[model samples]
Target: MKNFKPIWLMVCTLALACAPSSKDEQTAENEETSIFRHQPLVTHMYTADPSAHVFEGKIYIYPSHDIETGATSDDMGGHFDMKDYHVFSMDEPGAAVKDHGPVLKLEDIPWASRQLWAPDAAHKEGKYYLYFPAKDQDDIFRIGVAVADNPAGPFKAQPNPIKGSYSMDPAVFQDDDGSNYLYFGGIWGGQLQWFEDGELVAGRKGPTDGIPAPDQAALMPKVAKLTADMLEMAEKPKDALIVDEQGNPILSGDNQRRFFEGAWVHKYNEQYYLSYSTGDTHNIAYAIGDNPYGPFVHKGNVLLPVQGWTNHHSIVEFEGKWYLFYHDTELSGETHLRNIKMAELQYNPDGTIQTINPMK
Candidate 1:
């Protein structure tokens, strides 16, 4: 009986040694799961070029999905090879964000060849339209529209590209009068073109097009009114943004007020706020104007200089608060494979935006 008791004691010791305590079990569980916050917004996937809007009392964020390449490339060049778009939503700012998954993919658009870049969305006549820019089979980038009934969509791409827009980063802005304007173009390699009577016409082409770089104001963002169907541009394109009140152009050589790409416009308190990622894609600054077609005076910075190589963003008001949705490279550790991040945007008494702190 004493010998049997020793064997039983040995068995008990082995069991106790193998089993973890409750606290240890809890710690292990936490280490296995990641807690996502509203600050970085969408953690599970890499998202960039956020186009946020309020739909049906909830904020929906449409961002370009940046897929990580397992192997390193020269200068981290191939990291920006994004092929899809994702829509993330939440009821409140600090609440848990829901990833609605890939709403649109590169394969869905037959005309689209590869590079699917920054996208924006708008709702009209009970149908939601997603504006996206991608390269065609000829390798030229053009803007296209996808349709869906819901905000979180399995969006159907329109058969053809938007007739006139020959650029990237398509942002759709709808006015209070139900009139919508489509803003599309990029800084370096994008074309500045317009639409008139549903036909595409060339506007101010960029330096890459063999057209010498224009002066500051001539280098501003482009805007065009959309036709009633919300697919094609209704009128000729206009240089509606980044000019001065006296109708003067800003210069690219002037580091302070230079225009780069990622043009995002939103009206706040009767002031037309045209915020954009300035030249070099590291900082975001904005200007204020009295009208949408702006001679927007350069207000100070929106997002202070960030660590990432390309800092693109959108400003939106949700639940009576304003937030700046942008991207950084904190998670990917490389400049190209960036992730979306957000900060609370503040405004001054005169309706100018306060400088946002750079993300660490």
Candidate 2:
């Protein structure tokens, strides 16, 4: 039998949803409460798949909310029963983060039903955009974008999901030139797929349908450019970043780098770092490339393995320091319930990232 723990935790990834919140409400909540005083991010509520971004001189975290499960599997609505998302922000280093409260909810998006999984955010042209993935009423997974004038927003939902997106873990990346890109896909047969310009670009067969794992590197990550408006894709998806020079994917069997899901793009010192969770779903790894569209070479692990069914993270620079934001089930007795955690990330003089020992 499969491990019940991982499945339980993954179940809450059933949908991705975000709703808009009023600025007055956001201010009221942040001023009234203190966060991260005890560390490990939010403790009062369960949050997972942390995607952190530095916006307008502040660090903001967009994470999935893990609600308690029901009496049984049937009662739980399905695994990953997430219905909404909250934005956490901090203005100063080593100070308590402020909870911006639920910025988006499932009910606000007319097209989607549930399964608010991992999400990412970006700022462009004075608008804050939330990129999320959720199951639509038709039972298909599609990516959606919600926009708000303020980072702490009562965001307005796009009438429909991104037309061609068909996977989970939607991430938005903005290059220094003001161009945007979306990275997504995850464990559907033990492999993840990629989308670009609202089209299917690259995909691989994996350990699905009781078949043996293929010799191909199953979990390779892919990327594509987004239009200036940050609402649509602008180019075709290309397979880059996680493969070897021969164009073969670097497998993890011989300790080679591999991709599972949760692809995050961060640029530092003019070099591109593509970080993601390994196929094991318990550890975070990364690769380096010269550009956003990469023939990225595998560097090494960014996060060691942890005690959870799934691991997700993002890299951000704040106050001249770099940090890796991720999650674990340490505080929760059950794997289905997870909370956000983070650790400082370091880079070698050669521009490679060092492995991180994430807090439980």
Candidate 3:
């Protein structure tokens, strides 16, 4: 009996020695969770062009709902046949996201014809406003406003689009002084090239063959101050100039730093940051200026190319941490059908942002 007891005790000791340590178990769990953290924020359906914001201690994402339409791919983005907007909310990053389904649709908008593209949201005086761009009956893109009582909304679209609003990707930036500004525009299919000296050229197809001469001043995005009611442009839209260290307008040929689409503005440490996609270059670049309307000096790329052709993003600080919300084609493996993602964004001591590589 004593010999049998020793054998039993020896087996138990060997089993305990081979068992995983608590630290090892914890590390394994963290690795599994990290894999999820890098994946899409919502996978039930495709969502892209995330315009994330922190509202009332919750993160609200206004994204373009990507649908599988058989439209052929083109430089004009004809394949991106989105027709509605959906609002997504999460208590925190990497947490469960709730899809508040179809906040605004094309059929409900009186002036919108088709193609509900990238959208952004803002809160003022206890009301939430959704600002989006859609093509009007004339096939020219126009920005529109919709209102809601809640962040996650079934918003009511205004009967008419904002007066003097053109182009796509409407990003509303509220400055520290309580002034709200609209930053918008995109070239090529977005049709910013069609406007010469602020007037549309009749019957002009593919202006400048899609770009100005290499030495020519690069096209600029438009910025306008919003009215007090947040429904109309307070004045004429002005060029939000992005320039080199020498203060020269970035040349049209410098695709790497040129403004193509997706304008986002956020302030940090009293400096205004203007970030946008360098469209065909597939990088998210930024510029810094002292004021909201800027002759902003170009910084560097905020994000490198992801798995898709288009990369749109928004930056917001939540719970004392900053995050970049962007999109990729990880889920559908198609450019037009993309999925939204979020990652932590960091800044240097000099206020320059650390370049984020999505492939990492």
**Model 3, range 28-112, lDDT digits (tens) per residue?**
5444433233568888888999999999999999999999778787777888999999999999887799999998999999999
Instruction: Tell me the tens digit of each residue's lDDT in model 2 across 163-235.
Output: 6666678787788778888888765521233333334444333333212255655445556688878887777
TM-scores, in order shown?
Answer: 0.82, 0.80, 0.89
Strongest candidate by lDDT: 3
- Per-candidate local distance difference test: 0.74, 0.72, 0.88
TM-score of 3: 0.89
lDDT of 1 by residue, 229-314 (tens): 98899887777557554656766565566666788889888887888877564678888887777778887789876656787899
Worst 10 residues of 3 by lDDT: 1-10
Q: What C-alpha lDDT, on a 0 to 100 scale, does residue 255 get in candidate 1?
A: 57
Q: Give the clashing residue pairs of candidate 1, or none.
A: 216-250, 216-251, 217-249, 217-250
The residue-level lDDT of candidate 2 at 130 comes to 93
Ranked by TM-score from best down, the candidates are 3, 1, 2
